[model samples]
Target: MVQRIDVECKNESYPIFIGELPQKLEFEGSVLVVTNSKVAGIHLRTLLQCIYAKECFVCVLEDGEEYKNIQSVQRILETAFIHKLDRQSTMIAFGGGVVGDIVGFAAGIFMRGISFVQIPTTLLAQVDASIGGKTAINNKFGKNLIGLFHQPKAVYVNPFFLGTLSHREKSSGIAEIIKMAVMFDKDFFEWLSMQNLQGSSLLEAIMRAILIKKEVVVKDELERGVRMALNYGHTFGHVIEKETQYKQYLHGEAVSMGMIMANRLAVQLGYLSVDEEFRIQKILEKNDLPIYYKIPSMESFYQSLFLDKKNENHQIRFILPHNIGRFIPCTHLSKAEIMRTLEEFCDD
Candidate 1:
C-alpha cells in the first residue's frame, strides 16, 4: 500500500501522498497549473487528464534556480489574475521546488490566503520542499530569504515524475534526503545506505524522507526549535548559492558541498569522528556530488550567516550532527570558530 504522512501544524493539518498522483483532489475550484516550460512540455497532458476539474489554466515559466525570483512570483500572480482566479480557485504547483515555492507563496497571499495543492515532480520537491509549507522566492540577499509558512492543502508525490530528472538534479534531491535521514531517523539512514536508488525502491526512499520532514515540521512549523534541524546543510548551502549568484550549481549540488563542510566542522568540534566524516564524503562522491568548492574567501559568505532568519541576537545558529542520525541546533559556535571551520573545509 502507498504510505501516507501528514504535517499537523497549529492552523492546519496537510496530508502528503506518497506514491502515484491521485486521480482527483477533494477540493473543488478553478485550478491554475503553475509550472516551468520543461515540466509542462513533459507532463502537461498527463496532468490535465488526471485532473477532474472543468476549468484549468496552465501557467509556465522558464526552469531553473535563476528563475526563482520575485519577478517569477509576480508573473504567476499576473497569470492567476488574468485567468480571474478568485478565493475559491486553487493554485497547483506542478513541478520542482522553485515552482512549488513560488506558486504556494502566491496562493498564500492571493486575496489573503487561498488554498493550494502541490504536485511536486522532482525528488527534491517530493521529499523536502513541497511538504514543508515554507513557500518563497529568492532575493538579492540569499536564497529563500523572502517567503511565508503557507502549507499546501495536500501534496501528491509521484516518483514516476522523476524519470526526467538529470543525474545532477537527482543528486540534489538525494542530498536533502540524506539530510533528513541524518537528522531524524538513524535507522532510515542505515536503510538508505543499503538500498540502490533505482526503480520502485526510489519511492520508498522518498517516503522515508517525507516522513522525517512531516514529523519535524508538525512539531515546529515556524522553524523555532526542532525545525532548525532541517537547515543542517542549508546554512552553508544558502551562502554558496549567493556567492555563485545561483548560477553555477544546482540547489542540491550546493547542499552536497555544504554537507562536506558541515562534516568537517563536526570533526573539528569533536562531534564527528574522522572515519564518519570521510564516509559521508564517499557517499556524496559516489553519487557524483561535488564535495569541494573553490570559493575566493569566507568573509562574504560568513557575513551572510547573520542574516539567517534562524539567527538570534546576531548569534548565528548552526545545525551540527552528534552522530550519524542525531543533529542538534542552538549549539552556538563563535564567529572565529565558524570562520576556522569554514577555512578547513572550504577550498582555496
Candidate 2:
C-alpha cells in the first residue's frame, strides 16, 4: 500500500510517496541519478529499470558523511557540466541523506537551479532528510552550514530499501523517530515505548513521524520559528559529528547521544523529570543505540557553538523539551551553565 503526504510550502508544494516502488516510473526531460558507490552497486540497476527517460546517467560518489563536502558537490556539478544538463534536467538522489543532500544542492545551483527528486534509500532519509528542502553539504566549520532551501519536485520512500541497511543503520533511523515522539507527540512516545519496534509497528511509526514533521514544515518552511524545534538533538549532534570529523558515529548515533545530553540539560533546568530522562535513555539503549560520549574540553565545545547554523546574535539557541509532548525553542543558556551541564556527560 502507498501512503502520500503533501508538503505545502510558499515556493513549491510536493508529494512524499511512501510504500513500495511502483512497477514503472515515469519522468519528463533528461535524468541523472546521484548516488554513492555502495548504493549504486546494490540498487541502482533496480532503480534504473523502473524509470523511462529520453536521457539517463548515473554519478556515484564514495559513501559516508566524511565526503559530504565541496569536493563531492563539485564532482556532481562536473558531471552535469560534462553532460551539458540544462535547467529542465532532473537529478534523482538514489541513496541516503548525504547523497540526497549533495544531489539536491547540486540541482539547486546547476544552471541557477534545476529539478530534483528524492528516492531516499535509508530510513533516516525517508523520515526526515528527504522531505525537507533543506539541502546542504558539510563545511570544515560545521554540518549543513553550506547549502540551500531548494525543495524537491517529489520524494519517493520505499520501505524495501530498509532491508538493504545494516542493523546499525536501521537503529539510527529509529533515533529520528524517537526524536519526533519526544519533541511533539507524547502519545507517539508512549506508543513507541511499549512496542518491540518490529515489522508493521515500524512502518506505522515512520508514517507518524513523517506526519509530525510535515505539519511543522508546512507552517515554517524556512525555519523562521516553529521549525527550529526540529533541531532538538541536532544542536549537539552536529557538534559530535564535527568533533569526530564525521567518522566515529553515524548521524543517528550522534543524535541518540545528543538527545541523552539534552535530556540531562532539561533536567538541570527543571524542565524534564529525572525519571523521564532515564526512560528516554532506556528506550535508546533498548534500540541498541549509544547514550554516552567522551566529550572534548569546555573551551573546544564553546568554540564549536559559533559554527552552528541556528546561532543568532552570538547566542547559541537550543531546543529543549518541556515534557514528552512539547518543546522550548530558542533557549539561550549561558556558556558557564552549558559547561556545567556538559561536565556530567564526560566519560570520567
Candidate 3:
C-alpha cells in the first residue's frame, strides 16, 4: 500500500509518496538520474524500468559522505549541461542521503533551479533526508555550509530498497527515528522501545516518524520557530561529522552520539534527569548505535561549532531536550558556559 504526505509551503505544496517504486512514473520532461556506483549497480535498472522520459541520462558518483562536496555536485551539473537539460528537465536522486543532498542541490542551481525527485534507498534518507526540502553540500569548514531551500517535485520512498542496506546503515536510520520519538511523542518512544528494529514493525515506525516530520514541516516550513526543534541532535552531530572529516561515522551514528551528548548537556543544565539521560542512551545502545565519542580538542570542537549553520550573533544554538517529548533551543549560553560543557566531554 502507498502512503502519501503533503508538505504545504506558502509558494507550493508537494506530495511524498511512500511505498515501493511504481511500475510507471511521471517525469515532467527530460530526466537525469544521480546516484553512486554502488546504488546504481543494485537498483538502477529497476528504477529505469519505471521512468517514461523522452531522454534519460545517468550520472554515477563516487559513494561516501566525504564526497558530498562541490566537486560531486559539479559532476552532476556537467552531465546536465552535456545532455543540454533545461529548466524543465528533472533530476532524480537515487541513493542515500549524500546522493539525495547533492542531487537536490544540483537541481536547485542548474539553469537556476529545476525539478528533482527523491528516491531514497537508505533508511536514513527515507525518514529524514528525503522528506525535508533542505539540500546542501559540505565545506572544508563544516557540513552543509552551502545549500538552498529547494523543494523537490516529489519524493518516492521504496522501503524494499532497504533490503540491500548493511546492518550499519539500518541502525544509522533508526537513530533518526529515535530522535523524532524523543522530541515529539512519548508514546511513540515507548512503543519503539518495545519493538525489535529488525522485525516487521520497522516500516510502521518509519511511517510514523514521517508523519511527525510532516506536521512539523507543514507548521514551520522555513524553520523560523517550532521547526528549529527538529535539530534536536544535529547541533553536535554536524560537529562530529566535521571533526572526523566525514569518515569516522555515518551521519546517523554521529547523530546517535550527539543525542547522548545533548542529553548529558541538558542534564548539566538541570533540564533533564539522570534517569532520562540513561533511558535515551539505553534505547540507542539497544539499536546498536553509539552513545559516546572521544571528543577532539576543545579548540577543534569550538572551531567546528562556530561554523554551524544554526549559529547567529556569535552564539551557537543548542537544541536540548527538556523531557521525553519536548526540547528547548538555547542560544544564550555564555562562552565560558559553552567551554565548560565541552570540557566535560573532552578526551584527556
Provide TM-scores for the models: 0.96, 0.98, 0.98
lDDT, candidate 3, 290-338, per-residue tens: 8888776887787678787778888889999888988888888877877
- How far out, in Å, is residue 336 in model 1? 1.8
Q: How many clashes would you count in candidate 1?
A: 0
Query: How many residue pairs clash in each candidate at the backbone level?
Result: 0, 0, 0
Error in Å for residue 78 of model 2: 0.5
CA lDDT of every candidate: 0.84, 0.89, 0.90
Q: What are the per-residue Cα lDDT tens digits for candidate 1 across 49-74? A: 88866588888999988989999988
Model 1 residue 304 CA deviation (Å) reads 1.7
Error of 1 at 36 (Å): 0.3
What is the TM-score of candidate 2? 0.98
* Candidate 2, residue 224: lDDT: 87
What is the TM-score of candidate 3? 0.98
